[model samples]
Target: MRKLWPVILVLLIAVGLAVVLFPNGHKSLRAEKGPKPAQQSQSRAVAVEVAPAVTAVYQEDLRSVGSLMSDESVQIASEISGRIESFRFSEGQTVSAGDELVKLDDALARAELVDAQARFELARANLERARTLSKSGHVTERAQDEAKAAFETARAAVELANVRLAKHVIKAPFDGIVGLRNASVGAYVSIGTPIVNLEKIDVLKIDFKLPEAALTQIFPGQSVTVEVDAIPGRTFEAEIYAINPMVDVNGRALHVRARMANPDLILRPGLFARVTVKGRETRNVVMVPESAIVPRAGESVVYTIQGGKAVETKVTLGRRSAGMVQILSGLEPNTTVVVAGQLKLSNGSEVEIVQTQSPSALEKS
Candidate 1:
């Protein structure tokens, strides 16, 4: 036991010496830890593509879908019910106002009118004779008064008969082009029944809607470019004449109407049209590539290089055309904006601008 105690004491001294010399275990066996993840990321730079903001002539225009309408449209119908006796205007014919379009059976109306005229003539003669007799004291004053009243009633009847006879023939209310016939000759038609369509298409109207946000960008008498798929590769110019004051709550849009000349008759109503409402042109508008914009939290943002770091910047956007967008605000001219590799960027992040475009190249004509 004594011999073992000496051996144990010597072992304790060696262990104490080792502890004093090396506090952390053997260096060869120890695991070496590298730099912290956050520290490493902070020291590393994110590679990104950038472009300098530039100025150019820019126009912000609104595009909307609409339908073309005739300047004046109505259905040719009879004012009185009768059988169609004849049609004075041919289908697809252009007629002037007051040109008779259709005729109906007016025999009964004419007979009644003739009867009314005869009665009116007789009453008038009796009235004259009654007054003459009253002056000579041959007829009583009451008899003369009755004859005068009868004469007035007969005259009214004649005028009413003439009006009825005139309604048997339907006339064009305005100068217009007539559509296909809805009723044939000898077909019975009632009042207000659609006989055919009449449209004043010498001038055409276009009806469309625009977002309520664009209310300030439009006005009456402004010109709009319209294109129809039916007539491809051609643009029809129109002038705005009306804008509805009320905004649609459900769609947040405004109704607008424009007029255009169709003297050539190249375009027709009911065609789907695309309307371009051009905004006022402005030179030297700040422009940037559309790819540089990043949408976040329902707002637009751009990553600009500031002090060799990516600074998340909020910006107001204007009209976008081609591959570019207008920077209405939030960025200075000639500022470098990240166009690519923005997905790896954050505010205050160190960035390496691998490729930067010159202002002239970015704003090239």
Candidate 2:
């Protein structure tokens, strides 16, 4: 039994050694007779066309909110107190300057004019007869003088009547579109009561209030661009017509006006608009690709190619458009910036420029 026990122990030890060393032996055997090579991992670098960084001249653009308004907006009111006899122009109708719009009962005016004309004619005849008598010494000089004064008075009355008769016909002050009529035919109207609203829309005035700091760039006759949210993809061009000389003390803003031609009359008054003022065109500024500007925290950063390695650089940026941004400071012209393949980069990280392109790499040439 003792001899069998030693043999059993020996067998158990051999089994344990085989189990512990089997995997390692198998690995060594495979190494001696190498297995097939593993496939390479796919690269993340995205292939993109690139160009050297260059300076770009940009026109400084000022953005602000504005509204479309009529060049001349006014509420037409009745000048004389009387009932509206008839309307020559209807609501939403276009009228020309001096075109009759409303007619008031001018029967009295007409009668007054007729009576004044007859009086003038009678006075003229009397004066003629008196002059002839005076010339022949048939009438006294005082009588001739009185006849002359009567003729002048009669003529003055006729002129005054004609002036009042003209007021009975209300004419458009300027070429414009008529709004809703407040008074209808046979409706009594008092002096200074609104009859209709008239607005000249051939040229629209865009009014906007902007920060007073922008006043430096605002001037009369400067070119401006306007956009309305309601009309997307459409932009209107205008010229700055005027800028208020004073700024509002409460809002700290200045009023600016731009004139836009509305030949088709597409723009209407009271429509909201977004305005862009083209200030002085800035020249000789460095431009970098938008991708190169990396936003970190509240600031933006970029990687510059320095000493053949990636270097962290903080940049001051301005006006981003067309996939590019203007460098206000912190970067010089001719500086090489890594636009693509900058995600995996760190300061002084070793990078191999794979012309084949690997998106995972942080350095881009």
Candidate 3:
């Protein structure tokens, strides 16, 4: 038992020494083996496409859809009911102001006018005779007064007859192109019956609605560019001629009207149009490709390559146009930004730029 005690004491001392000196010894040895090869390989450069931010002349423009109209449009109609005697103008013909378009039956109107003229002449003679008799005091004052009143009434009747006769002829109110004639020769048309449609297409009008927030940027005489689907690849320049004072409550938009010259008369009314209202031009603004922007949570960010590593940067954005975005802040001109392969990127990540493209070229892509 004494010998066993000595041996046990020795074993206890050795075990305490091992526990104190080798605590976590196996874990320490495993850690010394280093990280996995896969983890080490992940540190290698990630292939990405890069582009430099550029300074450009950025013209802030408001875009909206609208429709085209004529400078002058009206539905030609008759003011008086009558049977059409003849049509002086053909369908779709260009007519000038005061050109006779339709002539209604004037036989009854002319007969009435003739009768009125005869009565008017007789009244004029009687009035002259009455004036002479009144001057000589041969007729009573009451008789002269009655003759004057009768003469005035007859003169008014003649004027009324002339008006009725003029109603038989319908003339072009303005120089315009007439649409298909609705009334033909000998067709009876009542008052307000549509005869045809007249549209002055030499100058075209465009109407568009924009959000009320853009009201400060738009005004009369501001120039705008109009693109029509009917006329592909062609853009027309127009000047804003009028703006509605009231805003549409339903849409919160302002109504605007612009005029463009259509000397060739190729543009017709009711065509769909895309309107772009040009605002102030900002010079030396930093612009980046839209692909470079990474929206994170509620903020926008861009990955820029600095010192061979990707540095995530928070950016303030401005107006976006044509697949490019204006960077209001957080980016400098000529700074290279990662445009592609940003999904595999993080802060301080090594990046290998496989392609470097111009901002404009990136926009096209």
Best by TM-score: 3
* Candidate 3 or 1, higher lDDT: 1
lDDT of each: 0.92, 0.82, 0.91
For each candidate in turn, the TM-score is 0.77, 0.72, 0.85
Error of 1 at 136 (Å): 0.5
Candidate 1: where is the Cα deviation over 4 Å? Answer: 1-50, 280-284, 294-319, 328-330, 338-365
Encode model 3's per-residue lDDT on 93-192: one tens digit a residue.
Answer: 9999999988999999999999999998998898889889888889888888888898999999999999999999989999999999877788999999
Lowest summed-lDDT stretch of 10 residues in model 2?
Answer: 356-365
lDDT of 3: 0.91
Each prediction's RMSD over C-alphas, in Å, is: 8.1, 6.4, 8.5
- Of 1 and 2, the candidate ahead on TM-score is 1
Clashing pairs for predicted structure model 1, backbone only: none
Residue pairs with clashing backbones, model 3? none
Arrange candidates, best lDDT first.
1, 3, 2
